[model samples]
Target chain A: MRPVLIMVGREFRDGLRNRRVVGTTLLMAALSLTLALLGSAPTGTVGTSALSVTVVSLSSLTIFLVPLIALLISYDAIAGEVDRGTMLLLLSYPVTRWQILTGKFIGHVCILTLATILGYGAAGVAVSFANGVAEQGAAASFAVMIGSSVLLGAAFIALGYVVSVLVLDPRTAGGIAIGLWLFFVVLYDMALLGLLIADQGKNITTGVLSVMLLANPADIYRLLNLTGFSNISTLSGMAGLSAQVMLSGTALVGALVAWIVVPLSAAGLIFARRQM
Target chain B: MTSPSVRLVGVSKHYGTLHAVAGLDLELHQAERVALVGHNGAGKSTLIKLMLGVIRPTEGHVEVLGVDPAHHAFAAVRMSMGFLPENVVFPPSMTGAEVLSFYARLKRQPVSRNRALLERVGIAAAASRPVRTYSKGMRQRLGLAQALIGEPRVLLLDEPTTGLDPASRQSFYEIVAEFGQKGTTVLLSSHVLAEIEHQADRVVMLDHGRKVADGTLSDLRRLSGFPTCIRIGLPSGVRFHPELPAGMAECRDLDERTMEIRCSDASKLDVLRYLLDAAVPLADIEIAPPSLDDIYVDILRRMAAE
Candidate 1:
């Protein structure tokens, strides 16, 4: 436990020190603010719907951005150390491979969580101030969105760890991580859209959407946030179906949670056997 | 009984068809300063990596601090060991202080002591600056500081002095010597034999992944059977006679006034008597033992001949 914390602490400090984190955070904040202001302008029905639209739009953005932040913070966690030769210094200590992996994961998770909270917090405040909905109810919705984003981010961070261990070079790992993110964030949805277009509305239903949600944690997070905002019950109502066919709240959350555990465990296994 | 800090029995490591280390046995007692010297591709790096648990041996066993480095228990062994790699490149964003503190945290110890270590290694002033700003020597010093971070009981340093300045190198050796006095067994690998000749208590010489010679410097010299060289400067007007002693294999006229003799045995008085009999007037004489380089070359030559 102590070693794990030590490793986590190191990861946290390193993340804070990284210029990439600072630059990414600033870029995210600027984009979030710009979107918040544009959505809040008093124009038409869109202006009145600004707060809802911003919340919904940023919810998707958060799904994409949170993981990007996580991967940026974590994809080089091990490979960078190996390349820099600092891994030798760290491994020379009396910490187990499991401890090192867990510690680094925890640390990265903390950083991702912090960035999500702060970046989303700023966006939420900007939208609320512009839309005049800075009350307790909106705050609660924002909290749920942020929580879901954190879970989503954790899944990606673990994925990044897997990438870090699997690839020997940081540049390659970064490219692969970003490429995977693009797949899940943009390409997966496009593929789903193509499938729906092919099915024309006859085959496109909540069951298929639920199955698609299971395939990507980012989709599940978006679906959860969407349900929180509106009465998307047709999607939620599928819960009454058989346990295996239906995606329960517990199961959706569990699958996202599994995303956090399995990849990290696999990375630990690989790292333990790695020569350096 | 206290176990050896490091022990390797018939250890061998192979990379595909190339054997990096072959059938080697070694033990490092507590506080012993052992120097590993070999030419490139001689397996010195492989041996250090095996000790650090970075690489597993293909054959035989390696125990570091009484724990098998290949097992999970190796973590405990590594916790007490410090390693300095040959070429150290740190994360560009990390400050020196942050780097040290992070390593300290990874070791699960307070880093209050690391500040002094940073200062000791002469990088305390630049602790706040990112490592990108540090020169090669500074980076090497930082590597040394990180290696000393938990006051490790066992230290494996590979080409530790690669970029250090003379003053820093001197201080670095002093620090290593102090660690040795504190009972920290140090396994240092270098191609610079003379630099470590006086510092290492035992020297292990490797050639093509095999332990060609292992003992004190003098022991290796004696084993090589390299002849000690003597230079005799004859008085300006004297010339050498045709007849020379049997043991003296080669004689070269260094100058019109001087002749140098290569003798198998320098202690014999017959060579001098023969020079005297030939009316070779000698002005000054110098006798020097074979250096480590000479002995190393002789060993390699003898092994090749065999």
Candidate 2:
């Protein structure tokens, strides 16, 4: 535990000194503010009013920017240490490899959580002020978005860790991690849409979407947040019965919880046996 | 008569088809400063890794402070052991103080103790600066300081003086000497035989992943049988009959006044008497014993011949 804390402290200090955490936070904040202002412009979309625009912008940022930032922050966690030769120095201490991996995971999660809350929180406030919505609903939406974003971001970060441990070179680790994100974030959605098109009017029910949700944790986060808004719940319903099944209740929360645990545990196991 | 600080019983390590270390046996007693001398592929680094529990031996056993490094107790042993690898690089973002503190915390010890260690190793002033800004020598010093964390009972140093200047090297040895005074067992690997010869109490020579020779410097010199050469310059116009001692096998007169004798028994004072009785004119005399370099070269050559 002490070793883990030491590693965490070192990692946190590194994150701050490298300006990666700050830079990422600032970038997200800028994007969130831009999205909020644009959403207020009385645009020509299908019913994109001030409130809907603000909510959609926050949700979009949570879906896209959160996982990308998490991957960027954590993809180099292990391979970077090995590349710089600091892994040897760290290993020479009286700590196990498991401790190191866990400590890094926790450290990265902390940084991600802070950045997510602050970046998305500032954006949430900006949108709420622009839309003139009641503070209560806006706060609730902000809480849900940040909370689910953390869960989604943690899954991606652990995935990055798995990539980092499996790859020997930092650049390779980063490349593989980014490639994985592109597959899940962008390509997976396109593939799923194609599968729906091919299945055309068939019974693409709740089970199929549930399985797809399990395959991509990011989709589950977006579905959960989208389901929260009254305007998108009907569209989410038509997407699949799995969307309706997961809209509210134990299954939805349970599936999201599984998203956080399974990948992280696998990463931990891989890290335990890794040579470096 | 304390137990050996480190013991390796027929330890061997294999990487796939290649045997990095094979059937090695060694014992490092408490406070013994032993130098591990070898060529590049002699398995010196592999042996150190096994001792540190970084990698397990495929055959036989390795025990550091009587604990098997492959076991969980290896952490306890590691807490009391300091290691400096051949090439060391710390995290670029951490100041030297933070780096030391992080390691100190990893050892489950205090950072306060590392302050004196940093000063002793001669990197106190730069402790506040990030390690990336440090020169190679300063970085090496930081490594040395971290190695000394928790006052390790055994110090494993691999080419600890590689990037050090002459003054830094001298100061580094002084710190090592101090550690030895406090009963720290120091095991160092180096290709610089002369420098190690002055510091190590005993030398272990490795060639081709095997222990070729291990003993005191004098023991190795004796085992190699490379005789010490003594040159004596005599005054001009001094002539004497040439009858030398038995152990002094080869004697040659190089110039009009100088004679050189290769003597196996370096302590033989009778050679002086012979020269005195012969009425030889002695201008000046220079005695040169078989150095560690000579012993090392002789060992390598003998191995190659074998």
Candidate 3:
């Protein structure tokens, strides 16, 4: 346990030294602020304030942005080390394989957490202050958005590890990570929309829709953020999703947690059996 | 008797159909420096990995400090062991100090002690620079520093002197020799026999994944039965090659002033006495046994013939 923590500290420092933490955090924050300022429109009467509108836009932004950031940062975790021959040197020390894996996982998670929270949080605060809306419920909604976005990032980081340990070549791992981003973030939902459009209501039931939504982490993040709050749902225009598929907040969080745990455990098994 | 620092019994490693290591049996006693001499693909690295427990043997047992290396319990034993791989690398973003301290912390050693350890390897001047800026020899010395961390009882180095300059190699041997004096077991692998000839106490030669020869220098010279050369100088004005001595196999003019003679071990004395009886005025006389490299080549040839 001591070694594991020490490795985590080392990895954290490495992440900082390489500017992984600072780079990702700044990118996410800049994009979040851009979306927040432009996301709101001036209507005669406001159904919800600028804060909920920002939530709507930022949630959409996270789906495209967070997983890409997570995947980019973690896709080379194992394979890059092996290619550079550093993994051989690192292993020659008295450290265990699992410790190395867990430490990197934690370090990447910390980077993603910092990126999602501060990136979204600072932008969210600026928008609310400009809009002059300070209700407690809006704050809670903002917190949920930031928290679920981090979980989404963790899910992709875990998926990245699976690719990392399974592939021997770093370029192959990079190709796989990009492929995963396209499938989950862009193509899966687009395919689901196409299916729903073709079914025209009779065949594709809401329960089936719920299960399908559960399969993609981005959809889970969408479901958790857009529907969990009424003001957010009204502003994001995903209010229709809540009408058909019903899931408790706990279920949404559980699904995202599963996305993180299952793939990471698979990586652990593969890494343990590997010779290097 | 105290347990040998490293031991192997009938160990073999087969990669697909290629046998990396055939049945090999060896034991390295504590504080004894052994050089593993073999050509590429001759299982020198595989044998080192087996002793380190990174790869399990297909046929037999590998033990370190009396504990089975293949078992999970060897992790504790590994804390006391060190390894310097043939081609080592560190994270390019890390400075030399950062890299050594990273390994030091992992070994449960005091990170502050790395300053001196880095200096010991002759890399202290560049300790604060990123590893990417280092020269090849500097990186190799840094590798030595990391392997020497925690004062491990068993040290396994593979081609440790490959990229070192002469002066750095000199310091490297001196450092490991001091460790050897303090009861640390050092097993270094290399094909250049002369580099380790004077440093290693015993030489273990491998051919086709098996131990073809293992012994001290004198022991191997006697066992191989390779004839020793006795070169007697021609006295001034004596230009023709001298007459043959009893038990001398062949005599030939080696140079302008010397004749070279070869004799079996049992007849070297008789050959010397015959030269004396012949009233052969000699400028210089020297007996030369087979070099380690020659013995290595001879052993491999003998194994192939058998």
lDDT of 1 by residue, A84-184 (tens): 77677666667777888898888878877777667767887777666665434456656777788889988998999899998968999999999989998
- Candidate 1 residues lying further than 4 Å off, grouped into runs, are A42-49, A134-137, A199-209, A231-248, B1-3, B71-74, B91-95, B108-110, B123-130, B234-238, B241-244, B255-258, B265-286
Error of 3 at B295 (Å): 2.2
Question: Candidate 3's C-alpha lDDT?
Answer: 0.86
Q: How high is the DockQ of candidate 3?
A: 0.56
Candidate number with greatest DockQ: 2
Q: Which stretches of candidate 3 lie over 4 Å from their true place?
A: A41-45, A134-136, B226-238, B251-289
Residues A208-248, model 3: lDDT tens digits: 99999999999999999999998788767788878778999
Q: After superposition, how far is residue B248 of candidate 1 from its true place, in Å?
A: 3.2
* lDDT for each residue of candidate 3 in B128-197, tens digit (9 for 90 to 100): 9999899988998999999999888999999899977888889899999999999999999998887888
**Candidates' C-alpha lDDT:** 0.79, 0.80, 0.86
lDDT accuracy of residue B93 in candidate 1: 77
Task: Report model 1's TM-score to 2 decimal places.
Answer: 0.88
lDDT of 2 by residue, A31-88 (tens): 8778778766764455534544556567777777778888887888888888887776
**Rank list by TM-score:** 3, 2, 1
Comparison by DockQ, 2 against 3, better one: 2
Backbone clashes (count) for model 1: 2
DockQ comparisons of all candidates to the true complex: 0.57, 0.59, 0.56
Clashes of each: 2, 1, 0
